[model samples]
Each structure stands twice: as structure tokens, then as C-alpha cells.
Target: MTFKVGDEVTLSTRAGSRAVVEYGPYGPNGDIYLVKLLEGDEQGEVFGALARVMSTPVFRQGDRVAGFGGTEYSIVAGPFTAHDTWYVVKDDKGQHHPHGDDRLTLVSRAPKPVGPTYELDGVTYDLGARYRDKDGDVWRFEVINGEPRGGMNGKDIYGYSETLAEVQQDYGPLIKL
Candidate 1:
């Protein structure tokens, strides 16, 4: 049971997202364990999964996940009501999503498609607005190509549905996906 300062590990038994062990009661017999997540999907929406310990953890505290190249974001006061409680993330640039790049331009589409489909664990899923945390850090999301995807931020997890009417009432204005 040898863990390092920034060792990437999981719950080892439960359905937990991947995270880096921040501090491990590290020494001989510490009781509590501290860690920060490494990889995840469906921000704001919580999914169920079990802990499968990682053989190796990739990123760390000093490592950046927002594609900002090593710029660590600080999670300040959030839960902003504009859309939800948005965090006060202080950084050079706001969060960056995996799609907002030269290759995958998230430009609005005319007569936008119903929504983008994201398949997870062999099941197809549709989501609305993909959101970020306080620091402009885009989340692990697949945005709609033409329209905004609709869904709830972490504070608004009740905003999801396979029904178009339900999605429209809850997250229609957010995104096409």
C-alpha cells in the first residue's frame, strides 16, 4: 500500500471518479485521505460508477486540466445564480472546453440539430448546455454543433431528461446538446 504525494488512485471499491491523492494520511497509519479528481464526465450531472483503482494517475495539483497548459484554477465562491451558482474563478483565461478549439469549433448552427449524442458505457445520452465551474474551466462535455445543449449546472442537477418538452422547459436556452 505505498502511495505517493500525487498518486493517481480510486476508491478501489465504489463507483468513484478518478482523482489524484492529494494527501494520504500518507505516513504509516493516517485515518483520512485527501485527493482531487483527475478525469470525469457529465459535469453537474452525477452518474453512478464503482471504484476501479488506477494503475497510474496522470495529472496533479500543479498540472492543469482545462487545456490552459499547466495553469491551475482556484475554486472560489460559486453557485452563482445567473445560470446557477457560478464560481469566482480567478485565472488568465476562463475555463476551456475540449471542443472550443480550431478543430472542433462550437459555433452556433442554424436550425440547430436536436442535440448531440454522447454514448457512455454502451448507452446513448443527450445533454443540454455544457457548463464550467467558477474558473472558466470548461468541463468534460460534448457540446452541440449548432445549438446550445441544455442541462443543469452542479447546483441545478434536476435539469435533464430524454423528453424534448422536459428538456425545453428546463434547459432549452442553455445549449443545443
Candidate 2:
């Protein structure tokens, strides 16, 4: 439940991805930390979560899992997409199934994967191609990781997925369970 400032963690109860820990582990009100979400609708804003629900993801491709008396399975997928998404897992006998977000309790997450990334002022931003600085200026990138990166960099770093409903048509489909 303890966390350092740079730790990437998830929320056990609901949608969250490789969000960064911005502050706290404060006592007196149960250990809590403020996390800045890197994806989904809440990107760039700091929110709080009890330390109990925050932990380093320990699962990776090909890891083993088992229910109390259920069949053994292997993780055939990665972290949930858009925070609250599900995982696509496979069983020992070779069958892929989409498991609920809660099923992640059987396993944790591995380090956050690096997708499309760009840098400005030495700080690297991922997932989204556009970003706004503390000064509230908008900037755009024509390409990142060889793919078209779209979004608005004003007020906040809003990804194309957040700003546009036609994201799949332009950016391609997101990872599904």
C-alpha cells in the first residue's frame, strides 16, 4: 500500500490505467494518494484513492492464474484499455476469454507499456499526441510513432479519443477485451 512519488498504479474499484502518483500517503484519514490519470476522460487531473486499492501491476503476458477451485489460466493480454476495460485471457488448454476488471485481483499489472510518445520541455507525454503546458497554450504534432496524432492542447491535453467520437475511424480501434 506504500508508494513512492514516481510509482504507476491502478484503482482496484474502477477505471484507471498507468496513472502517476502526484502526492500523499497521508495518515489520519487512511493512507491515500493523489494520482494523475494518463488516459481516459480524467487525464491530467489529480484524484485520490485509498492506498489499499493502489498497487503496482504484477501481471504480464503468459502469467498463470487460478480461481479457488476453477481452471488454471494464462494471461494472454495486457492492461485494460481506457482504464476500466477488460482483459483477454486464455486458459491452459488454449482458449481465450474476456475477463472482467475485477478478475485482475488474481494478477497485478506489469510496468506501463509505452505507446505513442512525444516530448516537450523534457517531459514525455504518451497516448495523446497533443498537450497543453501549465501556461495553457495549445500545440499540435503532425505525427508521433509514425501515426497521426490528433487532439487539442488547450485547457488540458485532450486525446482524440476524448475529443472525438470518430476516433476509431481515424485512429483505428482501441484494444478491446
Best candidate according to lDDT: 2
- Candidates in order have lDDT scores of 0.36, 0.56
Q: For every model in order, what is the number of clashing pairs? A: 27, 4
Q: Quote the positional error of residue 133 for candidate 1 in Å.
A: 8.7
Best by TM-score: 2
What lDDT score is found at residue 23 in candidate 2? 86
User: Which whole-number lDDT from 0 to 100 does residue 127 have in model 1?
Assistant: 46
* lDDT tens per residue, model 1, 1-177: 345566655543323334565665533454445566543343232232222233232221222223234444433232122322123433456653221121221122224224466543454545422433343222223344433333332222222422333343443332322
**lDDT of model 2, residue 69:** 61
TM-scores, one per candidate: 0.25, 0.41
TM-score of candidate 2 against the unseen true structure? 0.41
Q: List the residue pairs that clash in candidate 2.
A: 57-109, 58-108, 58-109, 59-108
